[model samples]
Target: MTLLLIAATVAVCLMMLMAWLPEFRAEGALLRRWSKGGGENRCSETVQNVVDGFIGNFSAAHNLSETETARIREMKTRPGMMPVTLLLHPQLVTREKGRFGRGRNLTAVFVATGVSALIMPPLAGMTMHTMSLWLLPFLNTSVFFAGLQLLRCAYSDLGLLNMLVTGKPD
Candidate 1:
């Protein structure tokens, strides 16, 4: 059961990695298409609706972000109903997770790994064999990307909110 849990965690982490690749991303098709300008007319209302939903939810928030920050979001924004858009979108795959957010993820991964490493030593009737157990905690970056992905969604949503309030997508 422990091995299974480890394997599942690893698998999700691997999925997180694949989601980071450019060719595999599925969420930014709209934004990519938008950038091309040829695909906007090609985008279905459902696509627009996903964008609309994203925009609506995004626009409703109160934004205190700066102009430059808002400009970046507006320029690089992806089309998705959620900010998992970072993981699921090709456009965002190249961007590293935000600051502070990355630190938080590293803290989580290492902390979880560290705690497990400590506990597993006694459980396994062993000592000073921390490497394998420690590695197990970081088996995949699911936790890391999940955090970044959620934050990207949130910031994008906030960008959307700011845009709506200001009468521009900025």
Candidate 2:
């Protein structure tokens, strides 16, 4: 039974990993589509430009006042720590849900991995070493997704990652 589980897990992992692998053509196509106006209806360029200007102005002030002055008193202090504090507060608990959900998607890819990991061992009918050949690929894919998820989350924190959080407005 364990061997069967191992084999299934292995195959599933490989499939998921392959699906998630980087494809230059696919990425380039997506970039071109977005540039041509795939999502321009979601937000106007004027709005984005205004937001960018506001963020730039605030960031400059934040850097000059909080970072520069605080640097003289302590080396370990960071000026941008306050944003993270808001993220931790009750008014902002959704951040954790969003983070864990992203993480869970990465981990959920393991369901296939675990199945493959379990199936490979018994299918081969080898009793001495039960480890499936698929385990490495499973782990590798999981790690890859985990890293990608983290990158997504980090971009979101920087306000550089934008997605349609809701359906289009009628």
Candidate 3:
């Protein structure tokens, strides 16, 4: 039973590293674009304006009210806002959790790893060898990193939105 639990914990951590780490690294690179006066924002704006112009003209031709156009113009000011807004919405967040299920599973794995690491040394006591003393601290660090990894996607999206909305990092 103890060996099985240990194996399961190791599997969970490996899974997260294998599945999410590459994507996280790729997306994390975009965070730098959130800096003030970044060139990426300038590029994003050019695209934003084109989209807004298209939408505004479409709405006007369709006989939509000026109020509708105004609202769309307001929305147009914030590039990449709609997708983030939709993904982060309460309903969509729940649906996302249901769809991916990675975050929750990763959390459980990290927590379990931390707990077992913390507990094993004391439970095994004098029987624990020198290397075992380091396990608890290593697992504690792993827990912290795992949490940051889990939040990377949401943080990246928010950073992108901040660049779009405020034209700078917050």
For model 1, the superposed segments whose C-alpha errors exceed 4 Å read 23-130, 140-142, 153-170
lDDT of 1 at 72: 33
List, residue by residue over 1-170, the lDDT tens digit for candidate 3: 44554554455456545534433442222322232223333446644544454545445434445754454445433444432221321121221311212344445544654554554444344225545445544544464466454455454554443343334455
> Which tens-of-lDDT digit does each residue in 1-170 have in candidate 1?
55655665565555445544532434356543454463234456666555554334333322224542444345333333333343233122122222212333334434443444444434343224545555544443334545455445545644543343355654
For each candidate, what TM-score against the reference? Answer: 0.31, 0.26, 0.37
Candidate 2 segments whose C-alpha is farther than 4 A from its true place: 22-159, 162-170
Off by over 4 Å in 3: 25-28, 31-40, 44-128, 132-140, 148-170
Best by TM-score: 3
Worst 10 residues of 3 by lDDT: 89-98
lDDT for 83 in candidate 2 is 22
| lDDT of all predictions | 0.42, 0.36, 0.42
In the predicted model 1, the residue pairs found to clash are 58-161, 59-160, 59-161, 83-153
lDDT for 3 (candidate 3): 55
Give lDDT: candidate 2, residue 79. 19
User: What is the alpha-carbon lDDT for the whole of candidate 2?
Assistant: 0.36
